[model samples]
Target: MPRGGPVPEFDTIVIGAGMSGATAARLLADAGQRVVVLEARDRVGGRMHTDRAAGFSVDLGASWIHGIRDSRLWELAQALDVPTIEFTVGSFQAGGRPIADFDGAGNRMSAAESARWVADVATADRALEEAISRSAPGDTYLDVTERALDALERREDALDPERIDEIREFFRHRVEEQCGAWIGDLDAHGLDEDAIDGDEVVFPQGYDELPQRIAAELDVRLEQVVRRIARAADGVRVETDRGVFTAAQAVVTVPLGVLKAGAIAFEPSLPAEVADPIARLGMGVFNKVFLQFPERFWEDGVYAIRALGEPGEHWHSWYDVSAISGLPTLLTFAAGPFGRHVQTLTDDEAAADAVAALRRLYGAAVPDPVARWITRWGEDPFSHGSYSHVAAGASHHDHDALAGPVDGVLHFAGEATWGEEPATVGGAYASGARAAERVLGRPVDLAAFAEGIRRSEV
Candidate 1:
């Protein structure tokens, strides 16, 4: 095929050069199939961008390798000789001081009281599980979460009203972050569907390295935004901004947010099973704001500091990047509704809010950051939000529908399609491999890749 000649037909066309797409392209190409990857952005790593800023390897997109055991990401990192460090959640801070719990009036809970609160929260969780199991018609996760919190509040008589309100706010933030949706919009039953067992690990070299390594030898077409996917009787035609590419099989690896936004129009239109899940499944926003300081100001051994604030506040959780990156950097996270709200603010405004929140903890003398970076995944055309979650009335079956292929022509692969581990790089990698297996008509031994990680641990 010449450069300007008719678009060369490939055995498979993988869309969006993210973890899933890159993995699929690599696997398919290695299987002796001609593959071409189409990516909307100029870069190969879609939401796995790693850039050097202020002399530090900063991951602007995906950060954590998540799990080591049975993790494809961990396996890939091992193959590439990438270093990883265990990431642990640290202490909670309020009003610039370490505390288990704090009231609005600046009173902190004693160790005994904090222990009791933890027990109460556990009880509330059990109650919530029971409530979700026996949920009535029209019941929303928000209703159940509030009911659980109210039950806990009523049982804890020792706490003052102000203290109770503060605890409630904290619980709200925790639930929203876990569900990746506002309490009112989350499905209580589906919250535990995607839970995976294991400690999270960080890629010190940068999370993007895994995808970049996989896509190194693949024919990836950058800045080719796909507009329409028309499946004919014999093959599939992918119309992009640049040109049309035909392939016997096409794997759609774009983010759930982009799919929900209807960025690519299907010629025959997606069936109800696929389209309905796309509508029901929620696209979550989990953006990060990184601030680099000249020196570390926060305490050591504390990976995360919880800044007590009202519900839906943008800067509720602050991560100490100094622990892993060996740099004086504080990474703040905004998720769910708060994350969406933060996306609406200007870069300076969002940075100012995060700085003010930090000042509340560190005092007025906290020096201004020498460099700052904010990520707005919601605003990006390729990835409208961070990841995917089950909406209020949706179930895990929605994920199955999203992953299901249509007419053996169009296949879907992304983090959202992996119901067992949705919204993680590991899931995205597995999904891509699974999609390639579907095209190959045989199961690939993905578990074999993790043997190295298992042997290293032993």
Candidate 2:
């Protein structure tokens, strides 16, 4: 149905041209509705921003298509002919291959020791499952991990306290990397439903290509930072740094961190139902430090190089991506409390810390990086954090609540609003399509419009 007034500038206004907003705008536009997308950043891909200032594309934001089969973004990639490379489950990247692990002394740990540590993780997981089942809504993983691990240690076959704690920190770091939050802040039972099953893939052409392709045919206005949204009886009046736009309906697809920060004001305030979830859901920081070297100094064919010891676990994992772009580059990650701590340091300090950690594993043989790319997503005004996670007191229902539409004129869409798979491009795409469906009062399922999006490529 046509809007109930003089045709507005756009039938629907979508905010944030990230995957979610882009999907909503594309679908609404395909259905023949005039859709306009407002994005704060100069580029269309939001957190999917990829940097080529180093002379080659490296994703400064999201880098993976986590799952393929159920991923709407995967469908988009296939339909758009976007190239991706698989990192199969058995690959060294996923820890299937033997890890190149070194103690603080720069001595390589035996493969048997690494395998034992990996097996310990599975042992800890069994305890975690028990803890999760017994835990209450407000209990955190850190709280129950202690009790669960304590119980495991009580068993006759358990390892020593030192070894168990070693595996514990490893487990903690891995979870932090996954949810982008410290284990203490994560809800024990919250992530029980957060699993996505399928193979993982990365983009050789850069992850931004996906969002760029989606935004190409849409009316995307970049650098238009939205500050206020007022509820109009028949529509919404959106005020941004650029200008005010009134449309019959609006799809808000900004990052959850942006919403949590109250970056954009909603007139009369969002209802308690939506407002509560925004407050309850946790915003987590996950950062990356990519260093390009003059040459590969580490062992050849090795995918991961981990340095083990106290005060070194935060910068523990490093990946050899020289194989990807033919550049001698190694990338490491920091997440949770450590990620936030790294953000507090100057670029030089962070680089030094990364270098020092690398030196611990490879000794003084490691040379200075020729180039570096460090991310501070927590400090980025438009993002505020890397992703969203279920806090100790929050549940999946909060995600569903945040996704709820307001007054039929205001709809919400983003990775955070996706209960099934939050904090992923696929989730963002699915959420955006759902918001567009709400705006249109109908469904244009993924397959239905894959051709329309593909045709627009011409």
Candidate 3:
């Protein structure tokens, strides 16, 4: 809460004005504490950027609400009355081919085929679960999957070897898409974190609105790229390009990527518990290539497109996000290693590749794009990569260590610090609130802050 009269310093200095910092600052200030939010970029939302360019409001970063029930974000969305849209899974790709009908539902995988697949996919899911259940500590998801796949192949009723491979690749891509890392990098034991149960949704207007609203009543200083954090006689001293500020306490909400990159220097050096995780935990790569075409060439009612037969893993998923800009827009994703590889391409190269992939699926009717926006989170200085994931041999307890306070001088908050919902906006915000509580020496209901949120008029 950047609220309060002019003061020489502050009671708390919240670093990085993303969802986490914004929530921490707001909660602390409302509780009568002086707080200042320091953001590296000249904006409030960190990775939740709602890029307004070429007369379109497009989210270059996060867009979806993975789960809705018991969602702090959903509660806040309701309080703010943010406009939302639901995109049901409408297409599938089997053996590298689209099951969606081009003209209508007639070409789609038939009901019988759909039922058959449902059963097969269900079995695959069960295999994954069983593998996870029997996995040894420190085992990677890939290891668990291999064991499951081998057992399935030995089953008398197993499908052809090619089909089995397809199923394996399907789950591999899924984990890559969801965790933002290859299956080999995922820790089998850390996979099943708590989650909300409900339909998935996205902000058709812009996901950035949530952070913008939460930070409205607070004082957020933009373009203040933090470089170093140190313990001071008074409290904590934060050094930024613009200047320096000292506060009674500091809450760092920067992305785990930033920490992993050693961007901010710590004064006495963080303890082994914190430093170990920062070194061992994985920072994943996930990029987006949003293309706005001259006209819609794909079928209507298709929310997503997945092609297992794609030559490369670059185009992991394509989400139709025309609702945001009312244009013929489709945003495709690149995850895992390809997510990193795509960063090497020039803008034209990347956009052209995305269009080429679309052509393969939709035919030559796919025209040249009108406008394009691409991201390379792996190259961003502030956020070194997309997000955090529990890497192989890394325990979910790593999140706990990252969140743990250092010498009662430094507190932590970010998606990487929360295990239940790591890599999620809601989890980040909750971690912020929790950090603020630690400084306030009290407990506060997170739901109470939902009232301060509202959708922007845009």
The candidate that achieves the highest TM-score relative to the unseen native structure: 2
lDDT for model 2 comes to 0.83
TM-score for each candidate, following the candidate numbering: 0.89, 0.95, 0.90
Query: What lDDT score belongs to each candidate, Candidate 1 first?
Result: 0.75, 0.83, 0.78
lDDT of each residue in 366-391, candidate 1, tens digit only: 67887888988888899988888878
- Candidate 3's C-alpha runs over 4 A off are 1-8, 88-111, 194-196, 232-234, 310-313, 452-458
Shift of residue 46 alpha carbon in model 3, Å: 0.5
* Model 3 lDDT tens row, 1-458: 13242343889999998888998998898888888999989888999998776665778877777678888877778777888886533332232223342211212345466556556767877887898998898899899988888888889998777557656777777677667798899998656883446777788778998888888878889999898888744578889999989887899999999998888999878989788988878999988889988998877766666554333245645777788788888878887888888899999999998888766666678899988999999999989888898998898889868997887868999999987888888778779888988898899776666653432233
Candidate number that wins on lDDT, 2 or 3: 2
True-structure lDDT of candidate 3: 0.78
Candidate number achieving the greatest lDDT relative to the actual structure = 2
Residue pairs in steric clash, candidate 2?
none
Candidate 1 segments whose C-alpha is farther than 4 A from its true place: 1-8, 89-103, 106-117, 154-160, 309-313, 447-458
